[model samples]
Target chain A: MPTLPSLRASGGDGADPGRDEVASLTFESVTKRFDDVVAVDALDLEIHDGEFMVLLGPSGCGKTTALRMIAGLEEITEGRLYIGDRVVNDVDPARRDVSMVFQSYALYPHMTVRRNIESPLLVRKYRVDGDGAPPRKLTKAERAARVDEAARVLGLTELLDRKPAALSGGQRQRVALARAFVGRPQAYLMDEPLSNLDAKLRAATRLELVDLHRRVQTTVVYVTHDQVEAMTMADRIAIMSAGRLQQVGTPQEVYDRPANLFVAQFIGTPPMNTLTGTVTTDGGTGPAVDVGHGRVPLPPGLTTRLEEGRPVVVGVRPEHLALSDEGPLEQKVRAVEWLGHECLVFGAIGDSPLVVRQTGLARLEPGGTARLVVDPAHVHVFDPETTERLP
Target chain B: MTAEAVTSPAADRSPEVPRSRRRWLRRYSPREVLLALALLAPSIAVFVVFFYRPFLNLLNWGRFESRRNGAYFEDVGLAQYREALGSDDFREGLWHSVQFVLYTVPAGLVLGVLLAVAAHRRLRGIKVFQAIFSSTLASSTAVTSVIFFYLFNPVVGLIEANWLNDPDMAMVAVSISSIWQNMGLSFVIVLAGLQAVPDEVMEAALLDGYGAVRRLVRITLPLISPVLLFLLVVLVIFGLQAFAQIDIITKGGPVSATETLVFKINRLNRPDNIGIGAVYSIGLFLVTLVVTALQFAILERRVHYAR
Candidate 1:
């Protein structure tokens, strides 16, 4: 069971997650509406101490809005936010003690990297010295130490003197990271941090970010549209759609048992195939679904409740489809992508196309006929109207 | 490389270059340049005939000073230049102009930045405020001077300030009027610069825990440096050419306290010192040239354009 309680026993969950003293961040039914468009609608999320949580969604799905709300950059239309036990809804972003890494890596264009990273610390608070009418400015040595410490944290020591325009994209990202980490805030809010990098660079930065998270051990709320990024980096992913949370679970749980059709379709590559079918009783075993031209047996004990011909959607991942010389359902191969070690054959049966992943270097042509056998145990039935998974 | 190499050979393509270039130039024609040349040609021709030609003639004319009724006509080569350069009046006018610049430029820059920053936000009815702030652009220098003249009138003035009448404050009064007229231009320039900053940059700064003041000081100011430099250069030039404000309001009176270089040059229009006026005009031109060049040299290095 990948439940919160078990996670706590492993030192993965913080005690009293809603309490600001225990959790690094908490959103108590936060809602943000912009010009009648509800960007974030009654969202309740908590990031415990030392956890990496990714907010995953497609565009216009409110993930960015949720992250901004946590950063105190966006006004929370309703609900309260807490950082380490303090209600930060009315607090300005500067007082929130949370830092954000922007998608554009908006480095201050005028300042060198050192000055940029040092700006937050320098402006954090003002102090008056003994009998001094005015506040004392930071000493050169203090500023230098802070800059060096922050730069070392983000591996940006060599590039501190350079202007942002002079640095490459990856270096600019590091500078952005350095800027965020300089203050040593309680949490980090990263909005699509690696979306701008090339594929290889994205992979490399992903690993670096995980390692950095391990080293820093600070709570993080990462927002990304890429599910792979969400899955690879997040301890738990909160998937959103249409300004509503669709599902929240570990990578494998969401993959194996998605809450709805959107999550099922969104989390996988070459997505799960959904075929319209009718649920029929096959002698006391759970309601068997009669897919067109063949029947897929269901799990035990659902036969009596469901009617013989209730419309449903059968979802089976491509890898779960086994190929055979003489299977129940036949398909005509539409295309064949032959990797060196394995092959993926895409085919159409009746009116629906099926994707089958098979191991080995078997050559299948576009016109060839093949059999696709669905595993009864792996097959899932979803309610067509509600789009929720049914037993 | 493959895509380009597949195209027809350069010999065939090169022949069409001039034709397409000419067509492009024709379609997006430089109307401003043509209009500028058209309008300036007649003025430039008139200036050459009436101003430059007579000035050159006067430089020569000074060598042979003509006097009627028993006065001798003497030829003194470069003597008038030496005397004008050495004169206390020329030095006085130079100091007055420098003082005028000191009073006007800084005030204009500060007022412009303040108004621009205030009106740049998305406040309610802000557009109306911006329109009112820049409304001074509608008034000419002479009109502005006349408006301020009555406003600062000692007895019947709206402000009830005697500073305009006092020699100690005459330059400051005239600078106030000039600032009033020029503030609008400054506001417009700075506001445009402020508005041109991308919102993402500001949001990013906010997310990085920068307060409003830090963001403005560190990000907004630097991004708008080019505009500030432009406003500075224009205001300095306007400061140097402070004529109508002085002419209509002070008339170079109150013990010549408000007499700028242009006013001094205009004063040289008197029959006896025509040659000296040309010297002042030439001197003003040199000062403007040097000031503009120095401003550009010093400020250009500081402004960072998004490359």
Candidate 2:
């Protein structure tokens, strides 16, 4: 595990961790509560070894609570939580072998950058691998070498002597990250660590974070509310709302095949357009949805799940809706926004609003009628009662 | 825009009207300035009568020596100032005042922090404990002195020590009451400081593997150092101005061991010795000002103010 050869010159025999397996975190029906309110209700997520998992959600969602539970900063109010092979429901944060980066970049305001990074190694003793040996601390030289390496990796070497008050926001964030990764903990937990940064800096730091995760090869559980950040950096994104897990999949998988209506509306930029319809079999088609103005075809896989005159929700992405004159659906175009590269055509089919993403500016006028088409393969049907995708 | 518009022409036509008339007339209505001055007049008059006028009289009186029990006075000028300041009584009184400061200020800081840190927690009934810790602020100097005097008396005392009679320990006995009496204010202020520290910083320290003791020393203490410095300055002023505690408890007894500068000034403020008393009062004023200034200059850099 001592892959950093540059640090070996100053301190070779520090308490460096040996080849400990990258630990997988398992939340087995875990729940968290704050007085009468449930922050996380029966969350069962198994983050695999070395996976970059982003817990994506809005504010007041249980994403932060779940990350805190993994750090042992919060108590599990209901069930078992595992770090590696050990059930750490009652373990202290230090013994859990995890480090967290907070949204505030909670740097010690009085300490220099070097001291902040060196503090973890100074306070914690690492366990040697493969045997039942006791934990031992690193020597002073080893501590300095590790701090130097971590600072160099984070590009904070020049700022090692400065207090946090003197550093810029991006530099402070880098210092926070350096302090987190200096100790090769089992897993790194971050609670919206980049939300404090501006947009341009957040974009740049997102790549740096993914690069750091690649070099460390440790499991990183990053929590964020920005879907773009999740789509860019996550190996797997877990979407949550109101203390319940909605879906956990790769970025493209979630955008293409949302398990429910919430995930469908939340994952996209313009949000997926939804229309209410009733399933009817009297038209002699295998399964058809009477979408008020016209009937839209349903996929063959949903044939078993369809019932006559049953209300269902039809969904399609904005980019998938094509403007065809001979199409079945007619909408009254309300407004159009030309975004240089593409134009967003906003319209309404009766009372339900619809948006179409067209490449380049279209010759469309406001307060005019337009015919739109949805590909039969791209149609998504959801049960109006359960709000989950059907078939 | 209105302020600038009024000022630019006043600057361009400097010879016409006095700028004060034009400025006040243009920038503000006469009723506005009149109302502001009306609100400020009472404070200014009271300060002149009660504070500034008496201080000026004391400064002028420090130049002359009283004679024949205030029937006559001799303006010996700087000579009287030199003689009174260079006297052994003044030096001894200053030394005693410094000693009192050394004894009480450090105790006030440490014990205050101990009480504040102990009371500032998340457990049940903590507010009750906080109330008890700050209850000492309710005690008057005389009440505290009586309590300590009885607690240290030889015959009827609880602990029964001879410190009040001993030359060296009498000041320590006096300082104990002051430390106890001033604790409530210190605990309340320091607890406010501890509460103002953001919770995320402490939580981050815990997750960074700092144990309880280490976290307090390394994180909590440094974050509250500004409050500690403010408390230090207040305690120093209180220590220097200590008189009632000494009077009620030691009475400057046991060969005047507990006679701080204020106590000496109080004794000197008689009909015959009023000139020297003014000199000593001025001396105490200078000392207090210098010590408070020195504290801010030396400690402000080390104190961290969180943005």
Candidate 3:
């Protein structure tokens, strides 16, 4: 409920409540190229300690590629990777103090749940000294205690004896999470870990993961194509397209003030409507957006910066649109979708169809004409050709 | 109007055909069937001719008895079976066969797994190593036995080892030849299995903090059990049916120390005692069948298939 900048200024108390900085990872100009494809292009970001950061985009957006670079699973073409303080660009994946939960869950199909969890501890003991190969011996008691503790943390005590194949999808994901968290790595890299789960499970696990991040205080960089996952689970969301980062901000920050045209449509439910218009100055009064239907006057103080008669895009969220008896613009309703709490009416404005969200119920029918008005303060303007936000 | 519309021919025809039944043949087109049959036919024909036909002939030949030394003769119906089944010749031959399996199976499995694990990973010039690992497949068992026979020849061999004549080293020499001839196969099979494991699983293991050794013991081996089981079944069969190595290298000689069941059967190919030889052949067949079946029963539970 607090504003982003104010929240940043305040002592750290998030949904789960705490102020301590946990695990942090920094990537400095990380670039990874695979043969002809540039998987990651000049990516620069900081993941705050214990922050649940979601790298969200459509397929081939380089989200997975970025996560792999952080995990030391992929070679970084050009950049510095620091887990806490140490640069691990040359470190082997086995030595990197990071764990990854793959989209497929990647549960070792042959091993029992306990073995899978214990495997990390064994690896740690062998590599922790950083002298030689794995530890040649592990006392049974030490192995048992480690497995027991991890199983308890993941609520998998009863399923320790079961093979990965026998466990349910949710259980398998937990095992994967337990595997990742068993060694208590500095950060967790999850590559669409819940993408394989059913819709209901994904929702439940999303909440669980947020809570887990709070309790563990480990920085997590999660990759997902699902926007809802990004909105609900991430402390900060980084939206990417075509291997380039479009924007990074809190959920509300992204929704209220998207950096570009791409971010405007990428975030929020039902997407924002974009209308091509011309910015014109009338005498010396102010600049006005002329969107074919009618002219909507902009705030006078900000109008002088705008070029006269320049092409621009007026963006408005669906929820900000109001249906009125005597509104300025008229559209014929093409379809209506009734979501339990609200109704969304879709209508055509010239060649483009626009989405409008109305609270409660709507007594609207297909082919009916309605007057639509959007709040001026809630609208965003972008340079039409460049697609950059217009101040 | 609604009643008439409900009785339309299109509506009636829809329910007549079962959707699932229609899908049965449609799932695979004619081209798919042809492709599948084309791939499978050669192996099926070869198994019938080389394996089943010989097996049936051996079974039938085990009947009837005849003169072996020209002074002794009999018309024994399955009498040769009782004689071959109970004779010292059969017992000693069976013992040597078991000894051969003991010598070859474990050595083959361990070496195969070692080589496979070493070469499964991608490294500089790894493809060349992989090709070299499987190069043994080009040499026949006879060729390998001959090579070892000369390598370990007592008086004339280049090495001057006398391995074939020494009682302690005779079985060991035969085992070495068998291992050399068979290591390539086990390596190839296990390597294929290791390669088949999804990269995500290993990454998960590595991230889990499992070093290479723990990962190999806990994750890698178990995941590749199906392949290991396949190697076990194949290598054990090869060990049990070993003959060329004993024949060319030791000739089942030096007091029958290196004689395997197959080698003993080969010696039974005397013209007069065809029936007795048939009995030996049948005995070898039974032994191989029982051992293979027992192995499957025991090892099937240990194999963990991902799907």
Candidate 4:
């Protein structure tokens, strides 16, 4: 594929794509209800200008609904949405000046790629006073030029004459991207746009999207259930569960210091291993959590904040647990997965299942005993009753 | 050791025998063949009895002419076909049928699309509106024709119009009855097509800056073009073969102005004109064939079937 021309060179007036007019999005206590079910409940979030904000969660987490509400595809039942200081709750989707890429890549099947990219430009009702100006239509030549610029950026110039059905899945996705780009909207709302691509293609497209963002510098609100995409691309990740926002922070912040037990388990690939234990200061150590096997010491910083005798869940990431010669914890190995670079050892520690992400080859055999120790700083303790993380 | 050695030789020989026997047996299995024949019998019988036999008989009869009030027959061969097809009566009947098709086909298509698009939304009481639009399906053609006949009667009708007596308007009145009768079917078919379009496609269009009217014209219509074509073919066939509406409302009256091809064929069913009637039947069949072929050739090029 050929490299894209500089957006500045392509613009009629030598405008930089990075300096294009972008807007910040604000959701103020937005709620959407469907009869007896609340799809999104009192959500409050602010996306900065030119930021790539991703809503990450499992199915039915209201992530897609929130994105749709911003696009004005779904009505905001109880709160206000603003794009660039203008409250857009009552605005039509077209008038909101936001473009969207759907999960299905919803290309008009009957239209050629050129026509598909030109559709948004054709219907744009340009306003001067924001109220009563006559709509200014783009000329035929101008529309064609805009379509050509977008196609060149996405490497779709050769396929402009073909219909969507004639293109491959990945090509169709790029066409959808080109269509969204041609409109030059303030924000792009994408709903799991990469979910339909194959794994290898999805990874390649992920990098392309980050590069595109760097060049365009437009605000993007992307929704996906895949944490890998969220971790790699998002400037900030917002995690939602059961129609409520759980945590919103940088990827490292959310991973290293989860707001609750759900975020800890939901954000990682091998998922954090959790064991139920009771906080005990009676041990010789200052503060410790006693599982049935033994008592693990807690860091001094956390011990001062946690009360003794409180029932809590100890959360440890798989990579944090290491094999030691004589460690406090012992488990009988049940399974070993030997990936090329690393191995995953699954075993039971005192009736609680634990997974260890060991670097290099694993030597433990099934049914054999292995000693393990956890990094004290990486340990996370959650209040079992409320399921919230301890300071 | 002796038993194993003996069985090994026998097993090697047995494989060859069964392989060849199985191939031969599979080629003409009696039970499977009988089952396949049984499943296809009903459809084959219907095709032969209703379609093939009638068409062949009409072709054969077109070569003969009835004489002496049906007491005798003369085999005129291709001459009768040419003579009957060239007559002014046959041409007039065909012209009237074409006029009826013009009246009903476009009306049916436009009204079907309008009703389908209106009722496709998720508003409150939408089901009630759909039911009302589809209610005409319950009325038979003869029943609808009678109802319309009385409604447009010059003396006792609600509007008291002379539609059934005017030569210029008798076919128009009969066409009105046919269009009304076809609305329910057209609406249902078009609505099914509209429903098959995914909701995300419409949402994407809206985000791309399409208003309701533009979406219908550019997206909805093109997506449903195949369904509309199917409806067009059906309406053309119905309009050409329409009998009951003309029979009840005009009876080919007002100086034979509204006598379609089918009405002429029905009138020729008398004992003396059976041969000419058969010739007209063949001509109507050819006309329908040509029209349906032209429709597919022209419309299929524009249809975009979603992958």
Fnat of candidate 4? 0.50
Q: What fraction of the native alpha-carbon contacts across the interface, defined at 8 angstroms, is recovered by model 2?
A: 0.42
Cα RMSDs, all models:
9.6, 9.0, 10.1, 10.1
Candidate 1 error regions (>4 Å): A1-21, A125-143, A282-287, A291-305, A330-333, A338-354, A359-362, A367-370, B1-77, B154-156, B162-164, B198-211, B269-274
Which numbered prediction scores highest in TM-score against the true structure?
Answer: 4
Docking class of 4: acceptable
Which stretch of 10 consecutive residues in model 4 chain A shows the poorest summed lDDT? A8-17
DockQ of 3: 0.24
Clashing pairs in 1: A20-A84, A20-A85, A286-A302
Order the candidate numbers by TM-score, best to worst.
4, 2, 1, 3
> How would you encode candidate 2's per-residue C-alpha lDDT over A319-387 as one tens digit per residue?
988888988789899999999999999999888999999899978999998898877787888888899
State each model's CA lDDT, in order: 0.78, 0.85, 0.78, 0.86
Q: Each model: TM-score of chain B?
A: 0.79, 0.86, 0.80, 0.87
Q: Is candidate 1 or candidate 2 better by TM-score?
A: 2
What lDDT is reached at residue A173 by model 4? 88
In candidate 3, list every pair of residues with a backbone clash: A120-B208
Give a tens-digit lDDT track for model 4, residues B78-129. Answer: 9999999999999999999999999998998889889989999999899999
Candidate 4 lDDT by residue in tens digits, A1-391: 3344543212334433345443899999999998789999999999998899999999999999999999998898999999989999999999987889999999999999999999988978543222344656678997899899888777778789999977778888888988888877788999999998888778878877887876777889999999999999999999999999999999999999899999999999799988889888784546779877866667546743767777889988999989997788887899999999999999987888999999999899999988888788888888898899888
- Candidate 1 lDDT over B191-227, as tens digits, reads 9998888876798777655666877787888899999
Q: Which digits, one per residue and each the tens of the lDDT, describe model 2 over residues B1-307? A: 3222211222112132333654544677789989988999999999999989999999988988888887778998877778988999999999999999999999888888889988888888899999999999988888889999998898998666798999988998888888898888889999999998888788888887888899889999899999888899999999999898899998998898988899999999887888899999999999999999999999999898876
What lDDT is reached at residue B194 by model 4? 99
User: Over all chains combined, what TM-score does candidate 1 have?
Assistant: 0.81
In candidate 1, position A195 carries an lDDT of: 83
Q: Chain A only: give the TM-score of model 3.
A: 0.88
lDDT tens digits, residues B170-268, model 3?
988888888887889988888898898898888877665667787788878988999888888888888888877788888987888877778877887
Candidate 2 stretches with Cα past 4 Å from truth are A1-19, A127-133, A284-286, B1-53, B138-170
